[model samples]
Target: MKMTRFLATGVSVALVLAIPNIVTAKPEVQGQVDFFGGDGVLRSAEFDARIDNSGAAEGRMIFIDPSAAAESDPDGPGEAVAGAQGLLIDADFDCLVVTNNRAVMSGVIVDSNTPERIGRRILVTVEDNGRGRRSPPRRLTWGIYPNQARNWTPTDGELGFDPGAGTSWLASDAEREDDVPVPSNRSEAVSCDSFPPGSHTLVDIGRDDGNIRVRP
Candidate 1:
């Protein structure tokens, strides 16, 4: 009887150890980002993300265009001409996560010619479908003009475009005037390769080139 009881206790302990830990957290998501410039240009990037149950997100954004011209004045021709200098951006970005599928990112732009200027800032907001699979981000906006100061501040006022001002690129005049939803039948699903290849540089996350990491 003593030996049988001991075996039963051992079996119970083994069963407890066999039970797996349940993870109630949301699964990680991966997608592409496309920024529409005021110059009628669209630049692409890659973003892999993990959002917590509370809707907070953490991710990395890798801009495609490493070297592009930085426009200081989007409307003024003289400052625009003078400010047309090659801005080499450091593509890898650690983002500031916002709840409800939004993020703000900033990175340094290396310009040997202009040593006084700082870097650039980008804002991305996407439509959320709770519990359903997340679609590709809808709005990827950036500063059309570069910041003169060392600290990064957005140039929304200088660019004459503000989403909060009801002048967003995604907002139509009717939607702005009436605050009504615009009729659309467009899918948000997009692949990184679907964007124009020449517009930006591409990063292969699978390679060991140190652009991205699974654990990091």
Candidate 2:
């Protein structure tokens, strides 16, 4: 009787241990590649990811390109040329589906030549690209421009483009409105077999080499 009871207890413990695996069947992680760049030059890049745990060896991959630019004036007595504008994907991962997580983001141009000047802007969206979830990729081109033209005068006057959102064209009857989005900052990774001369300087992340552009 004692042996039988011990065996029954062991079986119960084994079943309990297996319950987690049975309840949450190891999710098959699926990843893929999505192209994001310009006509000839690359602007930005991102990789999609999905996993089961914080350190799961298996996961999915999704990538994208998020790029933009800024304009500043010349130095001292001159206008400050706007720095680079766009999103810098440091690293992102939300613990829960739509809750707590770490978003490592740095959206600004870093003067590769002078690492001193950095542009600032709030752009980029975190979208769902896994399993059976489908939603708008989340466009953030709104509020990405100046409100009014910054008059570039010497005698203590604002001299620069207005700061507002999405101004393909300036406000009514506004002058000197040249808020064109240029792709100055290139990706830090690219394929050697596919890159050309005088393109962006490639930076190696992990086992992959990408392109990097100086935020002008």
Candidate 3:
């Protein structure tokens, strides 16, 4: 009887220990951003992502591209900025990774304005740089606006701001009045898919301003 009781207790303890190992902790990453684009065809873009560990991501992204000349006549009948167009992309985020205060998200373009872009892959990263810089740019220039150029020109795939740390740039009245797009500096790369999805690689694309939280 004593032996049986001891065996039963041991089995119960073993099951409890195994439960933790069997039940893996899944992480969640979700966030949204509304910012400008420095280069590329993107004039400005916004992303909203709500993704869970089950590989289901619900979000959408919209970007504007103004190929027309500046000062397209605000009172014009057509688009305020001539030749400017907005593109939409419905994304499905299946992978996410977070480190420190930054988050990297990866997904596929389930739908897009460009029909041929459907089913393409997409990845992005965002960092909460607190509020922003205390002193904003009085004016925004395509190259370096003397805001915080890091004294170095961004390479082809380098971030607009310093990768290690820096506050995000907010558009000043000068830039806004100038009709420049949201992102003026080359603060971020195009994507974070270079590393394996879900890796703790934080590549902050220079977002204008928004909020993003990662529970991972």
Model 2 is weakest, by summed lDDT over 10 consecutive residues, at: 138-147
- Whole-model Cα lDDT of every candidate shown, in order: 0.41, 0.30, 0.48
Tell me the tens digit of each residue's lDDT in model 1 across 22-126: 444443434464444545454565655555567554555444543476555647765644543454233323333333443333333333243334344333323
Q: Is candidate 2 or candidate 3 better by TM-score?
A: 3
RMSD of 1: 13.5
lDDT tens digits by residue: candidate 2, 18-90: 9997766432211122323324333334423244544342211122234433334436445544454543322
Worst 10 residues of 3 by lDDT: 138-147
Distance from true position, residue 33, model 3, in Å?
2.7
Q: Please identify model 2 stretches exceeding 4 Å from their true place.
A: 1-3, 15-44, 47-67, 70-124, 129-216
Question: Each prediction's TM-score against the native?
Answer: 0.34, 0.27, 0.40
Winner by TM-score: 3
Query: Clash number for model 3?
Result: 5
